[model samples]
Structures are given as C-alpha cells and as structure tokens.
Target: MTTANLPDLHDLRERTRQFAQARDWEQFHTPKNLAMALSVEVAELAEHFQWLQTGAATELDDGKRTAIRHELADVLLYLVQLADKMQVDLHAAAVEKMALNAIKYPADTVRGDARKYNEY
Candidate 1:
C-alpha cells in the first residue's frame, strides 16, 4: 500500500497473519523462529551501515536506502508476527517499556549523557 494509505499496526498484523496462513506457514512462525528471523533481518539492516562513518548511514544512495528499507520492514514484520503469536500488543508493550525507561533514565539527569541508567 502507498504510504498515504498505510495500514495501522493491527491491520498490518492481520495482513501478515493472512499471508502466512495462505502459505500454511504459521506452523513455522513460532515465537522462536520469528525472533530469530527478526534478529537476522536486523543484522542485514546493520550491514548496510557496517563501515559507514558516524552519520553517513543516513545519507545512503537510493539503491542502498531501498535495501535498508526492505531489511527494516522485514525486521518489523517478524517482530509483529512474534508479538501476535505471544498474544502481546506491541504498541502497548512499547509504551510500557518507554514509561519504565523514563523512570530508569530520568530526562533531567540523563540528558546529554550516554551512560547506563544505573550511572545516572
């Protein structure tokens, strides 16, 4: 779908589910497999920036950018699939995690610092 008509998270998840079901692939989409696939996709995404200078990754050529985009999409798709299989709402989990992170790394104290939360 076009970016202007992009589906919501739930819709996207449902599409992914249906795609897998059509191929009878759900049996291979266990949490473990999905998580591993996510990890591999992330690594593939990282490979595009493996030797780039600090900020160069953001300035990729069209071809590289497209490749990175596909890798990122793959990672996201697997993550959504895994979360669905585990009966977790990815959006809710992310929000809850962010809330905990805010407490662990209070902005006022952590601002401009790169240290771990325990060091703040």
Candidate 2:
C-alpha cells in the first residue's frame, strides 16, 4: 500500500497493542523476547535471498516477493510491539539516528564508499 493510505506509526502501534491484548499475548512481549523474535523474523526474511546472487535476487518470482512482503510485515509488527513495550517513539528514534549517521558518515566524504565511519 502507498504511504498516503497507510496508518500512522502511532495507530499501528495501538492496533498491535490491541491485538496482543485480545490474544492475551502481551505477557510474552517483553523487550528481550520481542528482540529475539524480531531477529528470527529477520533471518527468515534473509533466507529468501540466501542462495541468490545480488543481481538474481532482484528478479525473484512473484511467490518469493509475496513471501518477502509478509516477512517484512512480520518484522515491522514485532518492532512496533517492541517499541511500545519499551516506550520509545519509533519515528523519532529513526529520525535521530539518521541525523547521527549523517555526522558519522558525511555524504561527500563517504560517497561511493561502504566502509564504516571510523574505517573511512
């Protein structure tokens, strides 16, 4: 779906919270557990590209793309739940991180380079 049609992060967070509450699953959604689940979801997402070269990966069939989409949704859901449990504003944190990254890896200096900030 397009960004304009999507629910804001706060709404998504509340919806996720209600989902867990309805299922009585909030007790299992501690930061640590959510983090582990998020990691597992990431691994599952990566599995789709495990054997494919970078160029070939971009040419995945519709089924693989659908699977990747679901995996991505799972990742986002887990992250939203984790952020709720931790009382962190995901949007704000992401913005702050981008600002920090800019300072750590200035575009002009880091252009065409993939090295870490210190490595450059």
Among these predictions, the greatest lDDT belongs to 2
- In model 2, which range of ten residues has the least summed lDDT? 1-10
lDDT of each: 0.87, 0.90
Q: For model 1, state the Cα shift of residue 75 in Å.
A: 0.6
Off by over 4 Å in 2: 1-7, 55-58
Q: Per-residue lDDT for 32-113 in model 2, tens only?
A: 9999999999999999888787827567998998999999999999999999888999999999999999999999999999
Would you list the clashing residue pairs of candidate 2? none
Tell me each candidate's TM-score.
0.90, 0.90
lDDT of 1: 0.87
What does the lDDT read for residue 30 in candidate 2? Answer: 92
Give candidate 1's error at residue 52 in angstroms: 0.2
lDDT of 1 by residue, 1-97 (tens): 5534655778778889889999999989989999999899999988988878863756688899889889989988998899999999988999999
